[model samples]
Target chain A: MHDIGVRETIRFLGLTFNIETLKMTWLAMGIVILIACLATRNLKVVPQGWQNFVEMIILWLHDQIDAMMGRRGRMLAPFIVGLFMFLLASNLIGLVPLMASPTNDLNTTLGLALLVVVMVHCLGLYFKGGHYIAHFFQPTPVFVVINMIEEIAKPITLAFRLFGNILAGEILIIVLLKLMPIWMPIPSVCWLAFSIFISCVQAVIFTMLSMAYLANAVKEDHAE
Target chain B: MIVLIEINATILAQILNFLILVVLLRAVAYKPVARLLQQRSDKIKGDLDKAEADRKAAEQTLEQYKVQLADAHKKAQDIVDKANVTARQEHDAAVAETRKEIERMKATAQAEIENERNRAFDEMKSQIVSLSLAAAGKVVMKNIDTKENDKLVNDFISKLDKNMFADLR
Candidate 1:
């Protein structure tokens, strides 16, 4: 079998950019968004049946956001909640027999990490103004280099952390399934349970970290 | 050298695959899901607001009812007290009229008894005088001598004078 790693997936088109992963990511994003929209199109206040269940999930996410982010967290509630739901859907879709998790690839995680990094910087700068950049010097001038390196490393580490976890977990599950045919049912059930739990946890952690980073930036800006 | 090139190509491929996934997810999943969630949140806030307003109104209405109930009870009690007072006054007036009537009857009966008693005393005195005059005329007729009759009349007059004088004092 092919190594099936991220390196094998990249290809350049002229001087512009890569194309395949973008298309797949977009497709996956589109399907789930469409489904979510249709599900909540007609919202009744006292939700009945399916609508009630969907609304409950949304409310639950809001509560979690409130708990983690506080009152200011309410504003970011929709974004963070939407991110988790979408990620969970994407991850679970990968578990389908013929499909693969988009997150199992480094490129997908990198894009998500890039988005988070951009959001964090934008928020931090907005709150701190020009002084936000000055935080790099921190305790001493020599720390400036260390801080800069850490800043640069942040996206790489975050992206790889998620990618590695998802890829390794998926691989282990697959290998176990193949090895124990007699105990196939057990592994399948365990994999499903574990994967779903991990997927949700990862989504929460990612969103929480982004919020924390932004909050720190804003706090620093106000302090100065 | 060939292995290094292949490794680079593989990395590139994986990156492309991931990019496609993210783009697809953003367009198809995130947009619609976010919109739906926002709508649901707004709806919940609205319901909560409505419930609060309704509760406030209900409390106000309850207060109004309590006031009205108290007022009604006061009015009922006032009517009862007024009726009792009116009945007491009527009873007192009836008793006073009965007493006045009884007093008037007693006064009239007393006046009638006093007039009858005076008439009886006057009749007894007249009867006694007539009997005494008759007896004196008889005695005069029987005596046959004028001087004797005169002496006897003088003695009777003296005796009457002494008795009358004593009675007058």
Candidate 2:
């Protein structure tokens, strides 16, 4: 359980890097890129096989984004879609023998959450300008402190939600394997299947929340 | 104790990796597929429009041909009717001319017959007068009475009827 919190570090050019999470992240990214390339290499007006599958997934994601953010949400589709894909891949890779899930790491999840938060704020500022900062002072001046704290807690909540779910699933599977080593295959398989479902749900939730945040930030205040 | 909460280079590295993945995937996959879909939709719309235009043009051409054919049929009928009327008029005129010529020949023949009959009647009358005169002379010469013979001749000539000689002339 302590190993879940500790990352194996590698020193290169006097900079400390988390070797395990970086390796797994790169591996997941490479898999996604390779599949994407193969699917798009011989693209036709009519799709087939993997291309058909990938296009369906992309269309589904686009619809989800559209539902969340209206027509303007299309601009954020590739980023949101990429985030979902990467997280889903990272989460599912943990089911493989001896492979650690990158999302199980607090640093990785926090980094992704911070990225989404930064993008939301930047987009809000770009779209709403000074009116974006004025939203925090709404209803009364006394509620401004509460609104600021709530805003600050958003990214922390987003990060921990994914990290806790994935890390807990991984730790439970490990404890199950340790306790029942002889008859562990059946329970481990069931747990793995359940974990896979959880991974998918967590990925979807993360993407949905990110889209919702972006929509809220960039949306024009209709109250006026 | 606070080491777990510390922000480090690993977080920065993950951010970089995520950004790189997003950029790469967007470039390689999403944009091209979306563009292809849009292009296919446009092409389909264009093809449909062209098909509709072609259909309308064909319909217009068919209508024009029908109108021209109807006009030609009417003109041909008119020409046939006019020829029929002209032929009928010419036939009637020829028949009228033939009837007039036959009437004129009949009138001329009647007049010639009348003239011949009149000449024949005059010759017969002269012959009768000569015969009567000869007989009178013989009688007169035999009996020796000239006044009585002349009176007898005058009475015979006056007693002849003009209507009785009409059939003979």
Per-residue lDDT tens digits for candidate 2, residues B38-72, read 77789889999999999999999999999999999
Q: List candidate 2 segments past 4 Å from native.
A: A1-6, A181-184, A220-223, B1-7, B72-169
Candidate 2 residue pairs that clash: none
Per-prediction TM-score to the true structure, in the order listed:
0.58, 0.72
Q: Write candidate 1's Cα lDDT for A1-224 as tens digits.
A: 12334222333553222233344445566665566656666655446665665566667866765555556655555555556665666666666665566667665676667666776788778766767787777777799999878777877877777777777777766777767886458877787788878877776676667666545553433345
Query: Best candidate per lDDT, number?
Result: 2
Q: Count the backbone clashes (under 3 Å) in each candidate.
A: 39, 0
Q: Which candidate gets the maximum DockQ versus the true structure?
A: 2
Top candidate by TM-score: 2
For candidate 1, what is the TM-score? 0.58
lDDT of 2 by residue, A121-215 (tens): 99989988888888778877788999989878989999999988998898888888887877548998889899999999999899889888999
Native interface contacts kept by each candidate, as a fraction: 0.08, 0.59
For each candidate in the order shown, give its overall lDDT on alpha carbons.
0.64, 0.85
